[model samples]
Target: MGEMSDTGRLVLLGAPLGNSADASARFREVLATADVVAAEDTRRLTRLARDLDVTVPGRIISYFEGNEERRTPELVDVLAAGYLVALVTDGGMPSVSDPGYRLVRAALDAGVPVTAAPGPSAVTTALALSGLPSDRFCFEGFLPRTPAARRSRLRALAAEARTLVLFEAPHRIGAALADLAAAFGPDRPAALCRELTKTYEEVVRRPLGELARWAAEEEPRGEITLVVGGAPEVAAERPDDDTLRAAVAAREAAGLTRRDAITEVAAEFGLRRREVYTVVHA
Candidate 1:
């Protein structure tokens, strides 16, 4: 294990999403010698270290969602003192929709060197294995849990053109898929990747309706990542100039700022902002 680097550094280590073999060699070295190993769960980290047969020589601290705000400042102080700090979560990359963002931000403010030890990531893995469009996609993380909130959120994203990736729990999978089908159309192509890269892994690819039906029978174990096809592109509309202007006017009347109203109207009419603003304002 090497001593802390002269320069204060923040290393974001990507722990194995699953399977110890997926862990990068650099990850092992960093865990062995970093001045501080801040993990989401120290117990889990210890188990992982044992799994890889690597000893973590540094102080192991818990840095999870509940305590991230309180722990960040202290970790920043350590980093400022030229200590090497490694951030790891229970799985995959740190700070990618995880609890490492707070520490990363603190390190950035302290001018600590920030780097990543990339390894397995469920987001990209699910996308790649889903047979969906990978060239362009978006990560929406987890949707709202409440039915009303989730439905509204889904409706807002219903017209999204790029493929969407989401993380959801096993218990909520049924409702989530039902909401997706209702909002984005039952026929939308999608893949439900459960326990990716682990034993008992399953990928169900079909219409959202089919996935919902499958989930109704039995819930899969482990983490779940959903990849849904984007909304189909509709042809451009050629509404009359008066109708466009009226739409913007209506939005403004409904308490939207001029800029905000224009954005909403532009999407509705499938017109560019510049085009909508020019036509509406003119």
Candidate 2:
């Protein structure tokens, strides 16, 4: 039996995405035993510690996106010094559309053993509560800010048949919903979840167009996740070239280049570029 090498040990501690009670046994054990805790937000970590009634023995350091570049060496140095290092994001799993990725890479590069403390996640939470298909789904983390860029992205994903999950900010919820309605069709079935496990948690299901309208008027609040139904099953008969051309034209109007538009249309029609190009140019 041998002690785990410090140089190769990295624990990815999952924090509660919401409701504090969701913290798991493994999470508490890791927090209690790890020699160093790299937190996205030290203050939040402190609060979570208070909620869990756990006192951490090691030093807690800030390691967020803004300071990730500068903090990597420091974290890596600590791990190299033979200390058990644990990485935690403000919520949910670290490095998942969060700030723990760089440190994870650094530790792995140094041959550090990495593991996780599974806990709550808004992505899965939304999907489970979405009232949509759970068998298959994809997570499309926060869409771009610019309307044009956002629409282009949605257009690209429009053909995705599996359920789709997305994160969005409160301020941009209305615009994002509007764009989804446009790209996926106003009638697409979807759910808008807000605040998750927090006190203000809310989940609303409706057509994308109506959700957009509600978001426009109601001013949504809290951490939002949107789960949308996949594209309707297309009939065996191929949609006419005219339909494909129209879709390409719609995405083009939303700012995607002709090249990108063609790709989007081809995906939607399950056609190859050469196939779509021939139809579009015909």
| Per-candidate clashes, comma-separated | 0, 3
TM-score of 1: 0.84
- Candidate 2 lDDT over 16-68, as tens digits, reads 98788999998998888888888999999999999999989877888898999
lDDT of 1 by residue, 1-282 (tens): 245556788899998877878899999999988989999999999999999999888899999999999999999988887888899998999888899887887788788889998889999999999998998999999999899999999999999999999999888999999889999988999999998878878899999988888888877668999999999898876898899889889988999999999899888877789999899778
> Top model by TM-score, which number?
1
The superposed Cα distance between candidate 1 and the true structure at residue 257, in angstroms, equals: 22
Q: Residue 111 of candidate 1: its Cα lDDT?
A: 83
TM-score of every model versus the real structure: 0.84, 0.82
**Residue 119 lDDT, candidate 1, scale 0-100:** 86
lDDT of each: 0.90, 0.88
Give candidate 2's error at residue 74 in angstroms: 1.9
Q: In model 1, what is the error at residue 7, expressed in angstroms?
A: 2.5
